[model samples]
Target: MAESLDTALVPAHVAVIMDGNGRWAQRRGLSRSEGHRAGTRTAKAIVTRARELGVRHLTLYTFSRENWSRPKDEVALIFDLLVEYMKGELANLLDQDIRLLVLGDFDGLPFVARQSLAHVMAKTAHCRAMTLNLALNYSGREEILRASRALAQKCAAGTLEPESLDEAAFAAELYTAGQPDPDLIIRTSGELRLSNYLLFQAAYAEFYFTDTLWPDFDAAELERALADYQRRQRRFGKTGEQVAE
Candidate 1:
């Protein structure tokens, strides 16, 4: 399926809101933990496929800040899975030349999880093929606020003038600073909302919503999304005729 895609149309950066893990498990009479576990496998497969398809950056909404409000046991399970994933995938990440990058407020994560993620990130830092970004403890609102605070601090210190700040300056202060904004953002399980993921970066992104559960979203599904994206004429606020000109 990927072979049929026009490589030129592939998004430079793809962001995914990996949803429906709990429902996937519930429907199968399994625990939410099981669903999350299955979702991790899908994540692994998608990362490999995305890299093969020439996506330079792939960001997964692994754990949101709001997710911490869930049951303690469920939250624990998620962190546990994260640790296991980092430990198990570090070698594969290095072997595939996929750099691991974490977005969001990572310092707020648990100690063991932070240690595991740090080790994997350090080990795979030199990989240049593609970047696999995981959004952990992430909140789009928080990210915006954090960046705003930094800018405010600079202004207070008289290092930056309020009137001199531009879009580039603001973006440089984001967690995704230096990375291309996602050209395509996908949400699985029919979710239509951004859920506070990449609010600033996704301002001009093409969104693809799928009913398929995260655990079931495969390479073929991704191909469909990319193919659809190719068919769209992104004018970026300009008229189609203007774009053609």
Candidate 2:
């Protein structure tokens, strides 16, 4: 399937909702933390494969604001894993020329984790090969609300007019301001919901769902998703005839 893919049809940006970690671990009689640990390995492999496949942007839904509701120990473990991954992968990220970008609320992160994330982001600022956006502590609704507040403040200060706001203008204030909207969004574990991920940006995206857990998703699964995306016809509301034109 990979061999027959039309490279030109590959989506420029791909987003993933890595789910089912707890279930994966439960099925194996391991702790949920173990599932998250295994998922990290899969994340690394997918990032490498995305770069190799010429995907310009790869956004992984690492952690969401809702995740904070989990048990304290579980949350701590997730952050710890994040710090460890950043510290361990900084060198490989630089060597591979992949820039690290974070989306969502950074202030909510633990101080040490925040420091580690900032360090890696700064160190890889010059990487131009591909962007790896980790959507940590992200919430699409919150993001939109934040952007709205910013715009509203500008308007209140007389520096901007409400009438002057356009889709592009509004989007510029978004967390994904400079990034292209995801062309394809893949969700593992057969989940069929967006779960507040890239809500604004996924307006026209093609979605692919798989029963495979995040801990087991690999390059082949990614290729299969891309292949599926390649078969889709994105009309962006245009009629099929108009699209053909």
Candidate 3:
């Protein structure tokens, strides 16, 4: 699949909304947990593939703030799988030079999950080739509000001027902080909405939606998305002719 793609056109950063796991499992007469397990396998493959394709940043919507609304057992199972994934993939992550970063409230997670993530993250802290961000307990609105409140606090303390706040300053407070904004955002299961994922960072991102469920979204599908991205002309608010020039 990499051989067929234009290397220069590959996105520097890719964000994914892995959706339809429950539906995928339902179609197979399997439990939702089973579908999540299958999706985890797919995530492993996609991470390796993305690294091979030279993607510097890869963010997966692993768990959201709203995901806590799921059934208790299912939520517990998801975190268990998260722990398993972290422990199981630590070696591979180090071998591949991919650093693990979490883009949410770390203290809010279950103790086991927090411990596993902390251990793996520390072990891979020096990795420089790529960064893999797991968006656990993340909410775009909450992040924005958090940033806003931080800036407001600085203002109240007279440490930062209200007039000095700019896009860069605001962005620096985001979870993505120093990382480049995503060039491509892909959502599976044919979902057309952002679902509150990366609302601010995706302002100029090229979106690719597909009917394939998360468990079935493989390397081939990823290649297709990249191919589609390469064919488009990103004007970034400029006219096509201006960009072409």
Candidate 4:
């Protein structure tokens, strides 16, 4: 399937909203934890597929700040699965030359989970082929606020002139600082909204939404999304005639 894709049409950065895990489990009369486990498996496969399809950056909304509002037991299980995944996939990540990057405040995570992430990230620090970002405990609004505060601090200290602030300067403080903004953002489970994911970074991103749940999303579905993206005409803010010219 990857061989069929035109490498030039592939998005440089792809962000996914892996949703509907709990609903998937409910439909099968299984525990939500089981659904999450299945979702994790799907995530792993997609990571490999995306890398093979020439995606340079892949960001997964693994754990959001709003997810903490769910049942505490569920949250705990998610973190446990996260640790297990890190330990299990470290070798595969290294072999694929994929760097592991966190796009959220991982320091606020549980001690054990933090340690696991640190270990995996450290081990994959040298990888250069691709970058995989896990958005743990992340919120777009919070990220913007953090960046704003940092810039404000620099201004207060006279290190940065207020008039010198620009989009590039502001974006430099984001979690995705050195990475390209997402060119494609996919949301599973038929969600029509961004749900506060990558607010600033998604300014001009193309969105792909599917009815399939996160656990059911496969390489074929991903291929479809990418193909759809390739067919679209992205002119930024220019008119079609202007772009054609």
1-245, model 4: which lDDT tens digit per residue? 55567788899999999999999999999999999999999999999999888899999999999999999999999999999999999999999999999998878999999999999999999999999999999999999999999999999999999999999999999999999999999999998999879999999899999999999999999999999888788898987642331
**Each candidate structure's count of clashing pairs:** 0, 0, 0, 0
C-alpha TM-score for every candidate: 0.97, 0.97, 0.97, 0.97
User: Residue 141 in model 1: shift from native, Å?
Assistant: 0.4
- As a whole number from 0 to 100, the lDDT of residue 161 in candidate 1 is 95
lDDT of 4 at 138: 98
For each candidate in turn, give its C-alpha RMSD to the true structure in angstroms: 1.5, 1.5, 1.5, 1.7
Residue lDDT tens for model 3, 134-173: 9999999999998999999999999999999999999999
Cα miss at 176, model 2 (Å)? Answer: 0.6
User: In model 1, which residue pairs have backbone atoms overlapping below 3 Å?
Assistant: none
The residue-by-residue lDDT of candidate 2 on 1-245, one tens digit each, is 57868888788899999999999999999999999999999999999999888899999999999999999999999999999999999999999899999999999999999999999999999999899999999999999999999999999999998999999998999988888999999999989999999999999888999999999999999999999888778888986632431
> How does model 2 score by TM-score?
0.97
- Candidate 1, position 61, lDDT: 97
lDDT of 1 by residue, 1-245 (tens): 77779987788999999999999999999999899999999999999899989999999999999999999999999999999999988888888899999998989999999999999999998999999999999999999999999999999999999999999999999989999999999999998999999999999899999999999999999999999988888898987542431
Give the C-alpha lDDT of model 1.
Answer: 0.93
Which ranges in model 3 have alpha carbons more than 4 Å from their true place? 241-245
